[model samples]
Target chain A: GAGVSQSPSNKVTEKGKDVELRCDPISGHTALYWYRQSLGQGLEFLIYFQGNSAPDKSGLPSDRFSAERTGGSVSTLTIQRTQQEDSAVYLCASSLPLRDRGRAFFGQGTRLTVV
Target chain B: SQQGEEDPQALSIQEGENATMNCSYKTSINNLQWYRQNSGRGLVHLILIRSNEREKHSGRLRVTLDTSKKSSSLLITASRAADTASYFCATADSNTGNQFYFGTGTSLTVIP
Candidate 1:
């Protein structure tokens, strides 16, 4: 079975620019989540989608960060007017609904570098 | 915000030795999961223990959960060089809908 995958495994962008990171979750996964991991830091929750309904967005650092999941599938995270502080590894994960707890599969992640 | 913290930022041991990592969370959780990441790649799920369960074993891996203390431990028996990587424990709070809070992780080096 194909696993969750992300695009642009590595990206380098100048500050003040915008970046879009994409995630393709495994087939049939009803839940998708986006997280950010800074150097030597723990995984920070960004947003989560369960079957097109997002119940949590409080983790987004600021207005510049937003994410959308369409058709209960793929998700995209957009960082508008990116800043140097926004640089980090953006991770995507999916699971087989809440019933299959603690078994979320993750993608390779997009390493965004804001220069 | 992070809810879990792993002790001993790093650990190094011989390939045949046992490796143990501990994690403590601040809130009640439905389940505690352990993940392994090599380099900076996406993490791979290693094991998961529900809050009600006290202990579990898979192959050479052993996971124990103590709800009273809000902590968990992962023990890898007879580890191998390929086990060298970072291990993280994530807690899924029951109040939250499938949102997992992760720890800072422990970097383990298995010297062959």
Candidate 2:
């Protein structure tokens, strides 16, 4: 693809419902990351996937938040039993390896609204 | 947790004026990067300053890093209304390892 792509640009769901977000990273990029940004807040680190190695799940806020990257190209973020406080924009970015100075390209992001 | 903190949460300036924003971090870093976001969409990488380098310039953007003080500054010369967006600073700590911690960001609005 020309750039990173995210599905379901906007999602509105009632509380306790499960929601899934998808991200397709730029080709040949080996590093993928997920971030959450609440209204009027900074970007919050969520998870990181690099190549085939085990993902860095340290940033996942809770057990309900989980992500998986298949074929090192596409990724998905799932939230079980969503809460109103989970309403925010979920962003996905990909980089060329995990270099200290590598630039990350971001997707449009999914705005999830838990009602 | 966020490692960088930007000062002046919001700034409103007229076009053609020089706009400067400051960022401070608590730990040593391998590099610091600046990014811009329009509305709440995707982020655009603007500039990056390595810890070894004290200053850098690209086009109308100038970035300075004072590693000793654990702080950095971004100066946008001759700002334009199109520059209206949220500017964020992200820091990567070499010792602590991978990932970048983003700052709270500074929202700049340029009035034409």
Candidate 3:
């Protein structure tokens, strides 16, 4: 339980439905990240959360993608009106603040499948 | 957009051989990190090499960074069957707010 933990390791959703993936970071890490990896593809940056600063939504693919971190520890990535293209392995990572080097610890990830 | 791109999309070698993967980035980076992922699993952090560092080693993993070339490499020595996985290089740019962009990755298969 020392590393990042993700719930519902796999989820299947109907197209147009909503899905929320959860991530629990290592207790003291202040920087959390969300990324997606499509089948046979590389990881894609989604959003970033760091210690109360504004969440970086720059990498979000569309308005349907959103994420929030509460109390700087647990985070959730929500996708509304999901399309087939939204299917991917959603990964969460946490690390010491950006200042303490960029090493990150990752969770098992939630594999989201939209049909 | 992805900032890093890896070369030789896939590699296969016999156990006890060495495996190397290279990555090239488009922008200046503060640090580059290597990660490994077995099929259907989350990424496992391998090693990180800062821009200021030329080379770093961790166990059987060795990472090297070349700021001038805007590239990095990860080397795994004495590969094993369990080493079969995908390897990716992520870059943290100098002023990109510390958000890391990942590379396409190289799928490595170390056969016994």
| Comparison by lDDT, 2 against 3, better one | 2
Model 3: interface root-mean-square deviation in Å? 1.2
Residue A110, candidate 1: Cα error in Å is: 0.4
lDDT tens digits, residue span A1-115, model 3:
5899998899999999999999999998899999999998998889999998898898999999999998988999999999999999999999886556858899999999999
Docking class of 3: medium
lDDT of 2 by residue, B23-67 (tens): 999877888999999999899999988889999999999999999
TM-score for chain A, candidates 1 onward in order? 0.94, 0.97, 0.97
- Residue A62 lDDT, candidate 3, scale 0-100: 95
Candidate 1 lDDT at B41 equals: 75
List ranges where model 1 is wrong by over 4 Å: A99-102
Span of 10 residues, lowest total lDDT, candidate 1 chain A? A95-104
**What order do candidates take by TM-score, descending?**
2, 3, 1
**Which candidate model has the greater DockQ, 1 or 2?**
2
Judged by lDDT, which candidate is best? 2
Residue B66 of model 3: what lDDT?
Answer: 88
| Candidates 1 onward: DockQ, in order | 0.74, 0.75, 0.75
- For each of the candidates, the C-alpha root-mean-square deviation to the true structure, in angstroms, is 1.3, 1.1, 1.2
Tens-digit lDDT string for candidate 3 (B1-112): 6568998799999999999999999877778889999885799988888889999999999888889998898899999999999999988877764688899999999989
- Chain B TM, every candidate: 0.97, 0.96, 0.95
Q: Model 2: DockQ against the native?
A: 0.75
* Accuracy of chain B in candidate 3 (TM-score): 0.95
